[model samples]
Target: MKKKLLPLALAAAVLAGTMAGCGSSSAASSAAHNTAAPAASSSSSAASSTPSAENVTLNFAIWDSNQEKGLRKIADNFEAANPGIKIKINVTGWSDYWTMLEAGATGGSLPDVFWMHSNEIYRYGSNGMLLDLTDRISKSDKFKLSDYPDQLSKIYNISGKQYAVPKDYDTIGLWYNKTLFDKAGLKYPDETWTWDTLYNAAKKLTKNGVYGILTPLHNQEGFYNFIYQNNGKVISDDKKKSGYDDPATIQAMEYYTKFIREKLSPQIFGDKERAEAMENGLCAMGFFGSWNLSGFAENQYMAKNFDVTVLPQGKTRATIFNGLGNAISANTKHPEEAWRFVEYLSTKEAQEEQAKLGVAISAYNGAADLWVSSNKTFHVKSFIDMVKYAVIRPYSNKTTAWEDRAYETLKPCFTGKQTVKQACQNTAKQMNEALAAE
Candidate 1:
């Protein structure tokens, strides 16, 4: 087991705002009841039996409030079937959620169940903070690791012990405003598009305060895709070093930064602001995740003006794919109940419900189709079809440590304070040192 030290000052800031916008109990209760049941039947009999255990409540922590409605429905249904168990879901934003989890981990008060990310999985799983689900999953008649994506299933397995089950996955796509393309007399992005096509379009589409596309500094949903598409790697396959110093990787990064430097996109914008700009017609295009399908579909302006397609190609077509896993705390008082709930959450029944509600692309193999068809306004199927070119996100035991540092080192490139080559070299030096330490 290994423990990576997190900056305490950053942890304090995370906890300070952790409770912001946490929904009220009444609201959660109402949403739980209002959740629509999925059309599919449970694939297995109840995954756990609690005949001898005392009635108990399990705390479930998640980040996205957007998917809370569907998850609450699943929780409500789980409670209905397992009358002795109740689920209390805590919804926190991404930054705060991890902060709260770190605090909880330190205080030995983690939620009974929580979402786990690849970036942090190694830190928690290797430290024995996550429950060992190997035996539970192995002995379960209803669950099999083979049933989930191999990449996702392997991610939660630290040193041959299982800790989490795949919940859902996301891939990147080119989300564009149809009205903007029409106004510019440009054809909509399609399979034939290449990086050059995007560049030319961005130049043509940059006339009226509106930028052609948002090139976010984000790795998973942004430059990572370009790096892979250009046959570059962010981390070496052996997971022992950083690949940022590679010529192809640096080339991809420089190309990405060109948009920001040339004024094809705003000098400063983040994920939320970029999405907002797209919705408000301030930006014509953006590289976003499939998870945004629900948000864009629900937004009146985006629903009417925007649609999605496969990201334009580079040397080859590719997108960074990542998934979240449902994990239980190693120290929970209600291990059986927690395992039961987690098992139920991984079932095809629950996964289907997640898809039908457009919460995300379900991890269950065939269920992604349902999610694609769930919202008809956009060509959501593009996300599903692009899976052929998907690359699993790059991560290691100390992913967050190096990822955060890389972002800081690379910021100067986006702000024009340093050359892309210099910034990338600096990031590689820092990342290599981090990996060596790990």
Candidate 2:
């Protein structure tokens, strides 16, 4: 079985891009948003060859099956180049990935190297459960930290130590079914579109059992967009407060809740909601990350009929772009070999292969265009154009736990079960509690 990364994305809906919450009224605030810096112009530490007689097997886990074939290929190449170090690919669904990782962390049996998300990176790094790779990273001529976008590297740092290397990056977009739009006699969304345009288009598209949009109440993909549009933050610097109660946050929440409040969006529950929405054609548009590209492309039910565009712009055009990092367990016996695996994975060759396979967009510069062209379907080009504005997800040790509470309390606002003010205040109170507990 393929090892999997944790399903934190589906379970709590973490927003992407560091820039998402950094929007400011002044140019300075905007400029304060840090981009991922390019990798340092040096190779990582030299790969020390361990004798073949002492070969050991290491478990590498990830969450997505779409990239299994490509990763297997990568593992094969790593073995061929390294001689005897074997990386056993273990894949699991998102739900089980985190459970297993948490258990592993406690039992001291975590995989030697595993996939890490932006939200949890700080938590793991700060706890000393993950290896500090800053010195190794700086020494590696093949692993220039500056190659990645600025500020991206900062996500993995905690208390002066860096623990993970970025795996890939993804941005959010408005994924729509072309057939649904054509049937409704409406045009597809564009970069110039705004919240008014989105709502109006969704209204026109709603008829019979079909709705114009499918927006989950989860903060990452749903409400976070509105939060950024209206100018809000998820948490404060000291990580002692929640931003849910901010007036801008409330206004953004109100803006997004309109679809469900106005009965323009279908009632949905759990995973079934997403599948039913797509399979039965219940909704024309869905907001999600680029990572969903592979699943939508391979789905027989929706593959040939769908396309994506930049999400409707709010006060300013912004979308969240999140990334995963490859982290080595601090307990691993073969730190050097583990570093080799990570180094090989980050290079342009492996990344390009990933893009060409259409598993997901690669984080390497110049490899994204290959992903857009990998498939001959809808206007995939627009998805790449969105990178210029992509922002990273908020990073904190308690980000996962805090975000869950925030979403749980805010969900009522979307369904009209609670007013925006009550939801925001409750969300803030609950989120602060979670942060405090951490």
Candidate 3:
């Protein structure tokens, strides 16, 4: 077994600090659990497995291919204890994952158990596309909602019915290429660094064929951290209005897009390509969520050349905090098998295994230390450290309706075709319209 990176107490302290409020955060694809806890000694769950459920195949779906290996290993452990079940994992890219899941929901063929994200949960959970696990969760001795953060659990709860269980949480971290910094004779980034420091360094690093940083036209892993750092809000407190036009939000976004205006960042917008830019030496720095840990650690180039640190402070320090949840399909024919698999995933033992395998920072309290230890090549502790001042990724009912459109609405600003102020104003208008309709 891999040893934990940090002390148990330290990890618990971080895990204990929950998302704090209702704002936001948390996946799709792949097919693929046993006893939920005490992994080494799986004596089976509270009751005997239903004989009719034997030889069952539970389809598990997730978006990030990076997590598939670690999750599959966990699934194998589950299968060992429960000989009757088999898991199949289906992998899809982030953009396509939601599309596939939505279609599955409409067609009544959703995966037996799948990952649920905060941005899209309201639509799924409210419409009865997801299994209502409230009663099952209450009865299961193997799983307890108290083991996870309350704010995260609230994301999957609609009208007080818990539809899912929190899986893992993430905070944005700054990834820098140490070799590039060395070449430019600049100091590495740290907690003390600020927005001005980043901009100045980005300028100095922009030389030869490599851009200094990657300012992707994305949200959660991109400008959302900046927006929150500058004390900007994405939506109002009541979830009935948009804050895109707020002065602070506009200024933060203006500063973010300024990177492209001054030629300090590449015009890259896609998610996968952001990491590619780093591995290929096209950019010296970028911001990405902790969930990317598995993929980043797997790349030999990133493993050797890069390190991670907390996001630079703006008006005050902040990072985007979010998490994913494991949910069952309401239409699943094998409800017992699906619940059992999700239950296994939620247990302390399985969650720790997930952390040890570098899959994600497990939502199970105190398991983060194992996750930090799973990858030794980079300073990933920054991910946990930022949780202190983390801002929940913004979300509300019908979040996707407006959030997805905000990207297209703001695309022109990244390319210097529109003023940041005008783009943000337009985005706020659109968002308000969507929220009002909701």
Candidate 4:
């Protein structure tokens, strides 16, 4: 996991570089609109007393609409317990959510409480845009930092200040269409499978109209796992450089791209398209996160024909683990109420509800068992079992900046325009520059 250390000057420089490349007037307009919106009244300090019985609505923001039903249920339960507060959920897709939050940060209109990601936490927390929950957490009787995973709790803690609370976590898994396996006369993926096994199965399954797999250029669900499994690092332990140019990293990249080059996987499919293709039976296998449970459970074909297993091994076994954190705006009018709600969301009861709805694997340790048993259609235990071998998702203060550049810089290899080694070399050069600037 990445630590927070970006200086404001470095952050500004990276943001300028990013925005200069994005020449979209519509995005600028949206930012302008967000800047002009009304902001929550600034509180003098964190509230220490129970909120009075005055009706108040807290603006809760999240990116995943698929989990809205479960969250709404949790909100309703919170309302029932408190009686004087109402929670209004604001659903925005992943990309737009950050854009709006960036705009909101500038205008002081960020949602009263919102979800925070590791990639952007340093930016917001360092800017003082998030409420300082350190004092409140210490004073609270119902919450304890030890209730969630230590790494997850530490992710949102910037410079000794607790800015957010862990909400849910996910680990990558190998999803396969069993029907395709049966048709290919291949056995189901299991603990004994390795990279070579996956390669051989993909070759055999690539017949007719369906490709054997879908290997999108996604860092989390795609190449990052392979890099780690091959004993290669993404960023160094000191967070000072890129590891893309390492021999093992390059080898892993070449191995992953081989699927695309051999036509065992589609050459063109974004993350969403890959999932849809899998659901529609155009692909036989793919690497995805535990959050896909909600969508897969609802998809008629996937519910009956799809299942998951631990990712095949490389030199060693590994999976990327990441989670969402719930945070409050620094300028919220009702700090006490917001804390009450945020705290409620982290409780074991709320987490269990989140799990039982099949929304996500709750961050609370034992609560994941409920999630595994919530749905019986697939081997959900595979996701939890992989946790023992999980590696925290690698990130840096300016992770998005370098991550975006690496993706674009490496695109040529995916299209056969450049050799994998050349692409890896170029990506390392650019990523190093980005890290140096930060």
Candidate 5:
């Protein structure tokens, strides 16, 4: 199942650290499980089948085609081991994925296993549209939920039940074209670099048609990083209101806007055209997660000089942690088999395979080394190393709706069209209304 990349809908008013406290499902929570889950009777026949007869055909869904080759290899290995079950991947782009899922949710025809994101976890889990893996994950030594960072695991928890197992986690970083930097006589970005250093480097590199930096005023890629650096909150204590008006938040927004306002970088959004621009070397420095490393390295233009470093810091080092999760469809005809496949996907071996394929950073703790070595270009290990201090992306149910409006309404702040405080107040009001409707 695919979903739209609702960039602005998942409003984050605070640092990624704030959302770490969200998924607090303890084994002790004692209400009966929600009936929205598939009935036990449906699984009775499958469960009773001999271990050798575990044979079942399940549909697995994913959004990106970039990792298809690697994921399919993993699936082949899984089928070979089980001898009873087979998984078919139905891949689509992000937009189509969401469109199909919204339709599926209404018709009860969702795939057996599909990718999940933090923004959609609460919506699906609360509605009982996903299978709860709390029991399976807790019992399997092969799938230790605790091995992942607390914040990451928590994002999948709703009312004390684990609805999904994390597939991978990503932290933001600065990707630069080394050849471009060298030609411009500029040093590369480093762990010790701050926002100002980035700004100055971007300015010096802004010669000819090539720009220095690329960041939008949107929440995820742009302001979210700054908000944390300035020590501001994005949501209220109850999570029912906006935290954008905080001084720290205001500072963060202004900081991001400065880049666009000053024309040191391109004032572009994360559209297909902009992505193509990065691949074609229209921009020198870009902010992205470790997930894009492989593609960046493979780009004939960007690859020749591509390298990465930790994101520039402010008061402290902070980077957004974005992740994809694996969930079981609540209406699947084969719950037991689906659960088994989900379990296999979350295992250390599957994660290592994913890393080895060099598409994304795996959520499993030790699987990153394979990804680092999968590519011989530059120091890909930097992608794996940044996860130690990474912060998972902050999210809420209204994330998509409010995030878009906030981005549009506040674009002026970065472009000098409006003052930071003015934009903050307006965007906060808009986001609060969106939250209230939820």
Candidate 6:
């Protein structure tokens, strides 16, 4: 289940060296647009065991650049506390991140420590690519699996061995154009807004070369929320079957794509286009994740015209929620140093610092409020408020394998090439085939 599309020329760069920081220059440029702001560095009082890697530069790879500033500050405190070990942060886009990881995994030179997600964690953990942290976590007084969200912790555990620690959790939010809403005389979206309310707003706002909303062919930030909101699951809870064919799921899909069918949303296909549409005022609203805060905040247009609120509910209140994990390479030369850096990241100090810096919603218990306070530019508390009914982003052992396959089958529905029901039914068939093989 590995994506081996990484160019061979870049494989050498993935090794610890001058070029170890970034894999795809183009992806980096797009991702770096939204990033960190200056914040006070907060140090930990916790102690570390003597490290063998006195001058080792631990390459820490992550996808979102929005977090780089905050994380770098945290790393500075860590280095100040422990003089010898150095942490080099590598920022890459989401797609390139996996390719770089796959290249490193296959070539036995993966980043000493990197980010892991529910979609790909199973492949890495099951393949013996990640260091087992269960014992270390049990031995440490500074870190504990119980300190984080239980669902997030379980995502990185396979067969009772913990491969990673929860870094942060994110839920989708409704990002809307405040300027456009004011012009249209429409009230801002709130917790009371339902699917019907969203559609009505989109219709009212769609006029004079402007879309009321943009829901692309994306899943996590698109129709997936609607499916769960309507009581339709993606993968079954037991991880054995597809729920795409559920009547409720198909109904929700129909409603989600209606904006496009009615020409209220442009047929935006790529991830970058989604953000651009909102930034350029081509669309009045879109669903984005909490991870986008740093980037979105830095964008002047978004800062002036946009504010995020909880996603509009359907049959019930729900949002597609998921968290990232920090994992060490099973093949890393400096295992002790890698664990030390990862341990620091998992500590309460680091997690709260992450929230205070608006990196992401820290998965640590009680850290969400600080994250809410970190950003005053918008009603970010809405991100934390939705936690009550947040659905852990759907997953299974072969999540990545089935997700793209299902997307290929259902993308046509967004373009009006197929009916939503037909697209969903076809997706179910392909998803079940992939799941059965697993």
Which run of 10 residues does model 3 get worst, by summed lDDT? 15-24
Local distance difference test, per candidate? 0.78, 0.68, 0.79, 0.77, 0.68, 0.79
Off by over 4 Å in 6: 1-43, 46-53
Residue-wise C-alpha lDDT for candidate 2, range 1-438, written one tens digit per residue: 101122322222111121112110000000111122223222322233453456878788776554565677666666665556877777654556667888999999889888887667767788888999989888876757777765666777777777887777777778888888898888888877899999999999898778888876655556676677667767776768888888887888788777887878876645434545655577888876666565455555456667778888887766776777789999888887788888878777767877887766777777889888887755667767877776556546767787655657777777778898898999899888887887
lDDT of 1 by residue, 119-160 (tens): 888999999899999999999766677888998899899889
Lowest-sum lDDT 10-residue window in model 5? 22-31
Error of 6 at 291 (Å): 0.6
For 1-438, candidate 6 gives per-residue lDDT tens digits of 001222221211111111111101123311222233333344344345574445888898877655677778888767766667777888876667789999999999999999887888889999999999999999977878999989889989999999999988888889999999999999999989998899999999999999999988878778888999999988898989899999999999999899999999999776545555766688999877777676666656667788999988788999877888899999998888888888888899889988998878898999999999988888898888898998988889978788878878998899899999899999999999999988
Off by over 4 Å in 2: 1-53, 237-239, 436-438
Task: Put the candidates in TM-score order, highest first.
Answer: 6, 1, 3, 4, 2, 5
Which runs of model 4 end up more than 4 angstroms from their true locations?
A: 1-51
lDDT of 1 at 120: 87
TM-score of candidate 6 on Cα atoms, chains taken together:
0.91
2-107 per-residue lDDT for model 5 (tens digits): 0112211111111111111111001010111111222333322222233445458898877654455567777776665666787787765555666778899999
Clashes (N, CA, C under 3 Å) per candidate: 0, 47, 17, 0, 18, 1
- Candidate 3: which stretches are off by over 4 Å? 1-53
Instruction: Give the RMSD in angstroms, all C-alphas superposed, for model 4.
Output: 9.2
Highest TM-score scorer: 6
lDDT of 1: 0.78
Model 3 agreement with the true structure over 277-309: per-residue lDDT tens digits: 766788999876687666556555666788999
Query: Judged by TM-score relative to the true structure, which candidate is superior, 2 or 6?
Result: 6
In angstroms, what RMSD does candidate 2 have relative to the true structure? 8.5
Candidate 3 versus truth, CA RMSD in Å, comes to: 6.6
lDDT of 4 by residue, 1-438 (tens): 000122222112112111111100011011111111122223311122465479989999876655666777777767656657878887665666788999999998999999888888888998999999999888877668789999899889988999999988888889999999999999999999999999999999999999999887777778888999999988998778899999999999999999999999998535435545666688899877777676566656677788999999999999988888999999999898998999878777778888998878999879999999998988999999999998888778878878877888888999999999999999999989988988
By TM-score, is 1 or 4 better? 1
CA deviation > 4 Å runs, candidate 5? 1-55, 236-238, 414-416
